[model samples]
Target: MTTVPQPLTLRAWRGRRVLALLCAVAFLDFVDASITNVALPHIMSDLGFSVQSLQWVPSAYLLTYGGFMLLGGRLADLLGRRDVLLAGTVLLGLSSLAGGLATNTGLFVAARLVQGLGAALMLPAALSTLTTSFTTSKDRHSALGVWAAVAGLASAVGILLGGVLTEGLGWRWVMFVNPIACVLVIPAVLALLPRDLPAARTARFDLLGSVVVTGGTLLLVYALIKAPDQGWGATRTWLELAGAAVLLGSFVLIERSARDPILPLNIFRVPGLAAANLTGLIGFAGMLSMFYFLTLYMQTVLGYSAIAAGAAYLPLTVGVGIGAGIGAKLLTKVGSRAVICTGALVAAAGLFLLSQVPVDGGYLGHILPGLLLVAFGVGPVFVGVTSAANAGVGPSRAGLAAAILNSSQQIGGALGLAIFSAVGAARTHHLLATGGSASIATTSGLGYALGAGAAVTVAAALVALATVNTREGESPMNKPERVLIVGRSPSVLVDAVDILRADGYTANATNQFDRVLDDYDVTDLDVLVFGGMVPADIKEQLRAKVDALNPQVTFVQGLGGIAGLIAAQVRAATSQETQDGVSYDEEKREVRLTLDTPATVTVEAWWGTSFTPPEPKSASMRVFDGQLDAGSHAVPLPEEVPAVASFVAVTVDSATQVFTVGAMPTAVTQLAPASANDNRLPEVGQVTT
Candidate 1:
């Protein structure tokens, strides 16, 4: 027999510890990406680099990070996730150290490239670990919330920290800080994570496909990065774009024929996968453009220092945290489609507000409110998109799913920055040529660019509304049945909850009955189950309180073990039958009747109907029992009876009753008595004479 694994409870110490570690790793990735932005000027001056060459410091990282992500994800699946994660962490730390100590531009750029590679390997592995470790939907949702919160806030935090570190300890410290932090993180990752399962030796590595895809992605990203500097219509830009297209097209052809493709083409067939990725792409594009334009506006137009400008983003970070929390809760209540659409619209509204900022605008009047709105709006979108992308994916493909999402964000950010920057620069140049001041021209350009970003965000919202599935991860067998299980042992509680959930019920188990009573509204529950270990008095008190609140709620008692409890709950839930003088034998395919005197009986079978209320119409069958001397009678059902028939109802004299077999319900009504000769099969859909 196969056994289901129990999910970790959010309240447990181990669960909290794992979530903290995962969030910390995610935080490091974002912080490292943005921290260097503030230190760019210092690095250029210290390394004696030209302005044009200095751009490579950030660009090199983006290239390697975006290019290698899919391959890294494939490695995680072919090898072990733990192995890939540890290797990446160590590499990230060493690269940070090398970057800090570099004496020349060449070495600095090389270190940045290595850092990007390390991040590519680390991110997807870490996400896969989190998704697999948190088995229950509730815990996974909470874990992803923390992950999303860290992702949303870390960029802002990085800017602030970079400014403080660069000013106090010099630019080198900005590079050195990540390695120092990794000293603490490396040991925790090793100690906290479980041992990896053996690698899948049978899985073939698709080296050719990997090379083709990586080259294609790198060329595409390079084109986008250089498009603003080089005229978009320039020959070099067009050639590179055309080359990227050819390479990507070849990758598709190669994957279709590869024995084991790095990215299986079939993964896209998963419901909502493509839609979610598209939403992420467009959404991230708008968000990244907003950050880039706003940062420039604060420093160049408003004359704010790096530290002051970074500090201004604190409100946005807090708003994102709030939105993540709300979105996580709403995922269970309303599903991903509604939450994502709502979030995208909110973000668009925020961007529209920011587009109206003037050169002389204060932080309070123009920046803060707009930042808050954008942060909150994007927060829910991140959560919804992440959930939609990963839903229903198997463990083997978990890393691939994470990698795709990360790549979407990275590529979207790069592309959005390129496109919006060009638009803003062109407008700025036009105004400058017409004799406008630098400040007015820059402000006007940025406003127009932001308006374009807002339009893109609105488009993302429409895409989400139209394509994201409403009932993600839901199974037909699992209706939304809310159940509460009270127990004394944690092990037993976890087991019972898993079993009930597997059977399609929404189950919550708690060892602390008192705490549960205080925390949850038990009256809203459909079923209440008491484990054998639960104290009788405590169970009675809780049950009495719940019954008073909702008298219709079913209560199951006297269950001894996890299996027993699950069985009892299922039986109680399906046992809604009202029988008088008739009974149906499911296995024997027969109906029996008991009578006190000579009386006519009518039997009917209702097929293909739901047991739940608001039942639909079903095909019915009727049989007549001629007036007969009393005691017991057996009526064998015809073999032609539909296999989908769910209930058999018998009417005796003037009485009627309803009963259900499996998921179908049956109802019987009083009928006139008929002679035994009337036992012939009635025409389909015709009333018996």
Candidate 2:
């Protein structure tokens, strides 16, 4: 009886406490950002701040939060997410406590700045934690769904919570709440979350590049926030922006020569990563500012009390929950583009509607409808872009990707708010000079600003439409992953085609490595399976060409069990069931090679009991090519390496060949020669061995 091959099995994280701890961090991020917005007036009054300085209250927090976020993300990746997360949690708690007890404006602003830093550290670490913890697609989708829902709800609900706390207990409770939550959550995080994993980056962290990038980001955010008040045409504004640009440009140069860069520029090449980050930058620029304007409209124009104004967002909060829940589930089904486009357009429509709220606007007719629409649309867009940014990313770079997305969003939000706030102020002044009422001028300014937001959101939709690929991800249950099988043996290829087709994949087979591109289009292909019989040089050449055609397609080194074993490896690559770099199968005495880049890999296996001193009882070495980019490849042991090898090590691009390995074992079947005078195909023995 023939046995079916077993694929790599992915185990989902079952630690609910770990998930909760991570979610708390996410919850804290949104709460900290949004809660302060509502309490700004109270803070200004209590801290004895002047009108111009009042803006600094929130700016202090936002400037640091947006600026340091990228550094925080890289820190999580370098130091380990668990450890970084704990550090950020502690910092945030302490900063919040300091803010709560601050006696003066300067002290409070200092506390807020540190609080922003803490938040910057926590957000990416928390997101990377959730992503790395969940190994399976379904589980990750569910977890991210829950995380997004909580964050979405927190954005609108923070305003309400701030209003309640500020009104009932005083504005100081807003600052106190963070520390209290952190104190309660710290024990759980320590008990549930795993410790920091050791890092592979041998060289020290890229300090020069990090410092330059952080300074650049901080300057850029500060300039954007200052641009409106200073006037867009101001010389100082231009100089600050230019300086920031220069610093950021220099950072790229520094990274190119750094032993290990904090941000590897190559990471942007990952499909959907750049598109998603750009989309977030544009989409969120409009979305976050809407919150600011709406709150201003309620308190400054409509004469509503803090609690009443806060209560009005209840519908928006509910809508966000519903939309995010549905969006997370629909992600792999409709793909990122469709979801992002749909959400952006819906949000645009909602923004346009909001732009029409008149001086006499009421809650239901003027505000609630628009708020609900924006909430629903914003929810899906947030979830979609987040997923797209992270799609197909390995565990090593998860934090970096998350941080990039957050940085884009933060920069966009800050820039958007500054621009809109300035435009509104300009319009309000224009109207007042033209003899309009204070209420009418204020309403007119807000309307025009919102209209501008609508236009920006439409642009975001266009970007998503142009950039995001709908066909290249792991979802769409209706269409199974497409795979192409390449090997020397006709029977093996035929068997692979039949077996994979039966296994519900769209599978194809070819015996020619040289003719792969001429015969097949690999752009939409997911996994490429190669038989051991294909020469190492030919495999490497084929991969280099295939990468140019479609770098996303994973190369899998396969072994015995025909279609069954090959199919399992394919499943593992697409689903991220196994580790990123390499895997080992003891029964088959083979190693699975996974690489993010093309490089020579020397695979060695050693066998020994306790009786050896300078040498192992048995050892085998196989040198694999100029480059092979793939999910996994078999490091099949020839007759030279016995099956009892105790350890296996893979070194990339090493000059040492060490020991020579033996030839292929005898085959069960062999291919026929090209002519009667010719010998059997060079790889026929290896094919069926």
Which prediction has the highest lDDT against the true structure? Answer: 1
Give the per-residue lDDT digits (tens) of candidate 1, residues 21-94.
88888888878877877677889998988988887887888888888888787788668788888888889899
All predictions: root-mean-square deviation over Cα?
14.1, 14.6
Runs of candidate 1 with Cα error greater than 4 angstroms are 1-6, 198-201, 467-473, 479-689
State which candidate has the highest TM-score: 2
Candidate 2, residues 1-689, lDDT tens digits: the string is: 11111111124244565666777788998878888777888888888988888888788888999899998988887787778888888999999999999989999999989999998998998898776666445556666767877888888888999999989999999999999999987787787766644221224778898899999999999999899889989999999999999999999898766656888876775667898889999999988889888888888899988888788889988998888888777875876688888888898889999999999899989998888889889888877887778775554567887889899999999999988888888999999999999999999899888988989998998888754543234532333356887777554464455345433366676776776787677888888887756778988988888888888888987542233334444554454322346656666655566665565554543322222322212212322323555445566655544543233444444222222122323231122111100111112112111
Q: List candidate 2 segments past 4 Å from native.
A: 1-13, 198-200, 466-689
**CA lDDT, candidate 2, residue 98:** 95
Residue 18 lDDT in candidate 1: 80
Clashes of each: 0, 6
Residue 270 local lDDT, model 1: 64
TM-score of 2: 0.71
